[model samples]
Target: MTNVFEAQWEASQVEAMEALRAWAVAFAELNQQMSSWLDLPTTDANALGQVLWADSSGDPLSPARLGQRIGMTSGSVTVLVDRLEAAGLLARSREHSDRRRVTLRPTPAARERARAFLEESSAEIAAAVQGSSAAELATSTAFIRKMAAAASGATTRLRAARS
Candidate 1:
C-alpha cells in the first residue's frame, strides 16, 4: 500500500518523464526545420553548432577535439572538414605553435548565417517556453540538466564497457 505522498511523487515523476520525452522530440523536430531553413545538411549543421559552442577566442578547433565532442572518428572529422571547406562554409589552417596541427574555423559568411539562424530559433524556443510559469520553467530546466548529465554519463560507461 503506497502512502499518499509517495503516490503523488510517483505521479509527478511520471509527468516529468513524459514532458522530457516530448521536449526532446519537439527539439529534434525543430532542429531539423532550422537546419533545412539554413540549407545545411544535418551533419554539417550539427558540426557547425558544435564549433559555435566550443569556440573560444577566434581560433578554430583541433580536428581531434571536434571529433571527440561530436562523437566522430578522426577520419570522419577530416571528411567533414573537407566537405565544409569545399562548400566555403569553413576553412582549415595550421596552428601557429604547431604547423602539423590543423584547425577548422567557420568562414565569415557561415558565421553571419549561423548567427541569424540561431537568433530565429532562439526566438521560437523562447516563445514556447514562455507559456510556462517561472517555477515550472525552473523545474523543467533542472530536470533537463539532470537527464542530460545522466545520459552523458551512461554513454561514457557504455563506451568503457565496450572497450
Candidate 2:
C-alpha cells in the first residue's frame, strides 16, 4: 500500500525523531550535571524548574500541584520543599485567602543562580538557531509541542494501566 517515496519519507521522519530523542537525552544529562553543580538532586532541580515555569506562566504552583507536575507523592514533595527552603532556593507562602493553601515560589537568589548557570548554554542554543526564519521556528516549536503532548498522553495511559 506504500510507494517508494512515501516509504523513504517515513523512514527519514523516523530518523529525525530518533535524533530528536537523543538530543532530549543529552539535554537531560546536561540538566543533571547542572543540578550537581548547584548541589541539588536532579529531582529537586526538576521541581524548581517546574515552579519557575509556572511562575513565568503567571500561575504559581502549590506544593500539591508541584508534586503532580513532578510525579512525586505529597510527603516526598514536602520533604523536598523543606530541603530547598533550607537551602534558600524556594519559599512556601500562604498567598491565598484560604490559609491552608501554600504556594511554592523560587527565591530571587535561586533565579539569579539558575540564570547564571544557564547563560552559556542558552547562548549556544540561541546561536544555533540564529538563522532560522519565524515560520521555521514556529514549525519547530509546534512539532516539539506535539511530541511532548504525545509523550504525556502515553505516560498517562501507562500510569492508568499500572493503577
Candidate 3:
C-alpha cells in the first residue's frame, strides 16, 4: 500500500497536470474567439490582444517585455508592433524622460472594439460557469489561480535568463 504522503503527492501531481490541461483548453477556445473578433491573422491578433490587455496607465510596453509575454523575440515584437501600428491598432511612443525607450499602446478604437468583444465573451463564460456547483466553481477558481501563478513564474524565469 502507498503511504499517505505518497498518495497525497501523487494526487497533487495529478491535480497540477489536470489544471494545466484545462488552462490550455480554455486558452485555445478564447484564442479562437479572439481571432474571429479581431478579424486578424493569428500572430497579429495575439500581439494586439496583449497590448489591449495591458495596464491603462497609457505607458507603452517595451518591445522586449511584450515579446516575453507573447512568446516572441524582440525582433519579432518590433515587426509585429510595426504591423499593428500600420493597421492603426497600436501606436509607438517614446518616454519624455527617456526618449531612447520606445513603447507601444493601443489606439482608442482598438481598445473600444476589444472591450466589446471581451465583454461578450466574458458573459458567455460566466453563464457557463454559473451552471457549475459552488464547490466546483471554487475548486476551478483555485486551480486557475494556481496554474496562472505557475505559468507567470516560469515566464519570469525565462525572461530573466534571456536578459
Winner by lDDT: 2
lDDT, candidates in the order shown: 0.80, 0.87, 0.81
Per-residue error (Å), model 1, residue 40: 2.5
Q: For residues 42-123, write the lDDT of model 2, one tens digit per residue.
A: 9998888888879878899999999988899999999999999999999999989999999999999888878877785577
lDDT of 3 by residue, 53-131 (tens): 6747554577787887778878888888888888888988885689988777889978987888878888867787887
* TM-scores, one per candidate: 0.75, 0.85, 0.71
Worst 10 residues of 3 by lDDT: 1-10
Clashes of each: 0, 0, 0
Put down candidate 1 lDDT per residue, 56-152, tens digits, no spaces.
3664588898887779999998898888888888878786787998777778877888888878778867777888899989986887889989989
Number of the candidate with higher lDDT, 1 or 2 = 2
List the RMSD of every prediction in angstroms. 5.1, 4.0, 5.1
